[model samples]
Every structure is written in structure tokens, then in C-alpha cells.
Target: MQHEHWWPRPYRFDALLAPGVARARDCAGGIIVVKQGGVPAPLLRLRHPHLAAVVAADCHHHVLAWAGGVPMARLAGRVPVAAAVRWTGQLLAALACLHDAGVVHRDVTAANAMVVGTDAVLIDYGLAAPPGSCAVAGTPASTAPEGWRGHADARSDLFAVGVLLYRLLTGRHPFPGPPFAALQRILHGPVAAPSTQAPQCGSAFDPLLARALAARPSDRFASAAAMAAALDAAQAAFKLHCAANGGLARVAGECRKNGNRNDKYRERERKYRV
Candidate 1:
């Protein structure tokens, strides 16, 4: 069952090309992986590094992406609302490309994405499948409830994105849990407005995310483009409100307190924050 989902093994790629295999002298987090794969290094040159086909000595020695960046999870409660919003746009853009290709990235979580410089790249396509191959793929916390019982379409990806965005902006997951508890939370938990947890998010931001995180697929945004537009509108509204209220800087202070921590403000203040 586990192998069923393994990314194509290195031998699969090796038949076409072989890469020199070298093991890292040291391992991170106390796990050392001696690599074993037949795919020649040249083959990787032709493939996207993140999706490269390099099998490990065991079953999990897969190396994903040649780049390193901070996982958004580690940046929780430090990401400002504005910074979160900016990242959301980039994520949506990446999804648009996937949806255009008729694929659904079944799994999209903070662990699956990394923030580098000012942009975020969506990673971990091992579970990405065409529409109608529901099969319950993806992290439990991020999976759409319908995925457990039906085919998850593009909207399903949007739902996962919504979950991510919510966490990014609020620091707290709309549904929190370890496994069964988290699944139950996703299935039966409350969808509180983002503002409730992070006032910096502003009330306008809540409605848009609410629709994205809606339990019912039909209740969510119709598409990634729609979600992006709604996000843009919310940002505009927030800006106007800030202008009228006379305290635009206040939002960043609360972000420091908690509520999806991020620090985009230090770069250029509110112009592109969130």
C-alpha cells in the first residue's frame, strides 16, 4: 500500500538515464539516508528537481527540490497578514497552471511549500492526479471532506489553499488536530471568521476565506481565479478602511502578537505586505 504512492522509483528513471549516486556525509534532524537509485545524474538535469526521480536506499530517500527555503509552518504567527496575502496570490497562480493542465494537486500544505525571498513555490506533486481520481489523497488536515468519498476536482485544491491561507493569516488552523481529531475538526469544527483570531486580517478578509474554506465544495469559490479576485478585492477594501480609520500601521503590530505571524512589512511596509 505504501509503495503504491511512492514517486516513480529511481530505476524507472535509470532505464532512461543514470546519475552518479553519492551519499551525504551527514544527515539532518538525526536521520542519515544512504541514497540508492539507478537514475543517472544527467536524467535529473532534464527533469524538474522537485519532481526528480531519485529513489533512496530505503523507500524514502527521495530528494525534493534543489532549493532551500523556510517552510511556512516554521514562520507561523510571524507572518503578517499582508505577507500572507501576497504568498496566497503566488500560490493561486501556481494552481492556475496546474488546473489549466487538468491536474489537481491533491496535497498542498505548509510542509509542501516553501517561501523563498518574496515568492512561494508549490511543491510535492507526488499526489497530484487528474480530476476524478479522488482516492483520498493529501494530508488529512488539508484534504477536502469530499475527497474521502468522491472525486476531488480543482475546487478541492482551492479548499486546501484556503486552509493554508487561513493558517498563514491567522496562525491558528481553522481546524486543529493530530489525526482523527483533526479530521473531525475539519468535518465538524467551526469556520470562524479570520478576523476573530487576527483582527489585523480585518473583517473584509474573512468572507472571502470563509467561502474558500467552506466544507461543501459547492460552497467554495468557483475557481482559483475567483479566489484571487476576491482576495484582491478584500485587500482593496482593507486599504480604504485603513485610510479612513487613520491607523494603517496598527495591523502590523497585532501580527507580531500572533495570528499567522509573518514579517513582510520590514521590506516595504503595507504596499505589498500580506
Candidate 2:
């Protein structure tokens, strides 16, 4: 996430970028706009000396730019499901790229998954631990079960991704609690499907969200790619149901306008079909 901010004292650009810290150069400002890096050296730095691919630079990239998109939570109201689903792909692709580069993103929430010109870039490595490292930084609710003790791993990142996925769909965190409370719930409470919290979402999507939030890392989708594939399938089903029902609903409304007595039956069918 590039921002209009200045570097702090003791942290210089040359020193920052030397370790291959991820940065964004602002052409307009004629300077590097944002940089995310940490500790000069450790037994192994989880996020520092970070390796990341620049998926997108501008704010217009990714699903957030889709037509009729919902405002980001921090921005305003809920965004359309279509836009959210579209952006889900970008997040998956970004994760794949990082893993391929031999890096594990410790943070993978909606906040870090910023949309840049219709592209989503994984940002904020403050708590990122190197692959297989025993260091972790990220919100407790988004952190994996093993992360409570500062264990960062590929699966842990996936867990955070799952939390993000759940939030995108329901507009609420599955585990809602203060830092300590949320962490305790995540460490002890059973995973709840989004449908369970928001029954309006229907049963079709609950399992996928549940699988993503599974307590056992192995039980969750083996990788972000797998989760994406599963979400793609669920989204297909959701769209199909909507398309079929939407057309019927419109016809029923038309029948009502014409004062057709039988329109009541059609309305029922439309409701169930949709």
C-alpha cells in the first residue's frame, strides 16, 4: 500500500532498499513513495529482505475498480459481491507469486491486500516471518492456530487469507473480539461458517469459508491456489442461482403490474428459484 508519507530518522532509502525491501516509486513526486522492511539481520527475517512482485502500482487496479463496486470497508458501505469475487483472484495470484519467490507473507488481510489499478499487492511485512520461521506478526483473528506462539508458516498465511475471504463476503469478522479476546476465541472456539453468522448468505458458501478457517492447517485448502479454485466454483454456483432467479423475479414483478391473479404463485417460484 503506497502512501504519501515520509521516512523516519535512522531509516534511509538507500539502506532500506539495499536489503531488497519492497518500495513504490512515485513518478509524480520523483521519489520512492512507500517502503516496507525491517531488522537488518536476524537468524532469519520472515518479512524483511522481503521478496515481492509488483502486481500493480496505481490505485485503480483489481476488483475494487469494477463497475458498481462497493466502497472499501474503511471507505464506506459494502461493495458488490461481483467486485469482491473478482478481486479474490488477484489476491490468490499475489500469494502464488510470493510463494514462488520463496517468501511467506505473514500478513494477508483486507487491509494489507490493497488494490492497485485493479491489481492487488500484498503489503506490510512488519510481522512477516521467513518461510518455516518461528516468528509472526498479524492480527490474532487472522493469525493461524500455530501462530499464537509466534510460529509463521505457509499454512499460517493461508489462515489469514481465509479470514480475509470471510470478511469480504459477510462484511464482518468471523471471530469478532478485541486483540486478546479474538485471539482467545480463535485459539479455542470452533470455526463458524459465514452462513452461520449471516444466514442470508445461504448454505452454499458456508463450507468454503469454513474450510478456509479450519483450525488444522492441513485441513484448510492446501494452498491459496486451492482455496481460489474452491471459491471460483462457489462463485459460479452463486452467479448461476442469481441469474436464473433474477430473470424470474423480474417477470413476476411485471405480472403483478398487469394485475395477474396468478402472479402470486409466480412470485413464490421466483423467490425460491433465486
Candidate 3:
């Protein structure tokens, strides 16, 4: 096999028959499984609540313990604004941890985030690189404008988070169309505010997304922690508005609808909670 050399002693290839295996394969980082071994030394060193755990690894590949949950992609348009805000905060926290470790997650798309219980976890580190790597990698729809010009850093990752938040709020990409067209829109076209696409999201998201998806790195949040703090404030304000206007019922209704649509995920969530 082409990957026969990827696994070293004591860690043999397992029969890749888990749900997480499929998801890992589908992810950009492409983490896989290797049977019966401790997590590799290098992979085990970095630890964070929101980062997926690695099971084993070698120079060419990493075997991550399956992070079982629904992909954020599946929750599009169904997530309540409060839930979306919370999840985005969790992802930003994850990014902060990665950034602090001197690593930049070049790929930060909806498909790369998994919702486990009430929390969000960031998976797949295949494209991760040190700061200022300028690799020109990541999914086009979520890539920052500077990314197309072969630059990627913490701010570039934040841009992708903005894209994910837009999808979660409005159930669509900000720059929707064919790949090239979307890339062009990201580069030069204007993005409508999330409230414009889905009024329920409110206007607070407008300025936040504007800053997050800014054309220039210097114009975006200074750090992931800073962005997360802003999101927390937005979430708090949203809660107050809902409580005063009786919007809590609407939020609950949306959660119920989403639960009905994803019964399996609810079951998985129950298992995790147990």
C-alpha cells in the first residue's frame, strides 16, 4: 500500500470501518486510524479542549481518535443565532489555542468543525502551518482574499470563521456561486451583512463579520481571543434582546426543528452527555 510506510512499529493499520474514519478521510487534513498503539509523542504534546485528539502518527500521516458529532455543515440555517454565536466562540477559542502554539490552521471551514453536545471541536490539521507561511491552501469559498495571493496567517483563519458564521446564520455562503466566481467575489465583491440575508440574525453580526472578513489582515481582529471576546459580547446582547422581546420561544422552536431534522445527531449527543 502507498501508506504502508506511514505507520511505524506497534501501530498497524486498522480496518477503517468507523463513522469517524469516513469523516476524517473526507476532511482536508485526512486523519486516519492505526490499530493498537499510544498517540505519537509529537501529536500528544499539544492539548486543548476544542482540538481533536490524535491516536497515533508518523512523518506523513496522523491517526486521530474519531471526533464523533455532526459536521457544522449539516446545521446550516437550522442553528439558532445564540447557538451559532456560542459555537463560533468555541471555534475561535480553538484557533486561539492553535495560534498560541505557533500553529495556524490554514483550513477552517464548516466541514472541518464538529458539533459535539453543546460544544464545537476543530478537527483536521493536514494543512496547518507556522505563521506567515503563504501556502495558498484551503477551500476557496472560505479562503481570505490574501490567501489567493499565497498568504495565510491567524487572520486568514478568522476570515474562514466569518464564512462559517455566515453560513450558520443565513444557511448560505456569503459569496455563493461557482468556485471561481466565489473566489472573485471574496477578492473584490461586497458581502451583504448577515442580517440582510436573515433578519433574525440582527444587525450586531454585521460589523463583526465586516471586521472578520476584512480585505486586509491589519483590518481584522488582532487575535482569535479578541474575536472570541467580541462574539461573547454579541451573544450576550442577543440574549438580552430575546428575553425582552419574547424571542426565546422562536429560538426554542428553531432548536426543536433542528433536532427533528437530525435525530441521529441528537442520539449521539445523548450518548456523549451520558
Each model's C-alpha lDDT?
0.66, 0.54, 0.72
Q: Name the candidate, 1 or 2, with the larger lDDT value.
A: 1
Q: What 10-residue stretch in candidate 2 is worst by lDDT?
A: 60-69
Cα lDDT tens digits, model 2, 1-274, are 2312233332223224433343333333223323234421221222311123222222221111111222233311133344456666666766765665556777677766665444445554445445766665666567887776776667777777777767765667878868877877687766677665543344556777778777777877877688789878887766665566564345334334433323244432333221
The RMSD of every model to the true structure, in order and in angstroms, is 7.5, 10.8, 6.2
- The numbered model that scores best in TM-score is 3
- The deviation in Å at residue 24 for candidate 3 is 10
| TM-score result, candidate 2 | 0.65
The prediction achieving the highest lDDT against the true structure is: 3
Return the TM-score for each candidate structure.
Answer: 0.73, 0.65, 0.79
Ranking by TM-score: 3, 1, 2
For candidate 3, write residues 121-153 as lDDT tens digits.
888776776777766777888888887787788
Q: How well does candidate 1 score on lDDT at residue 236?
A: 86
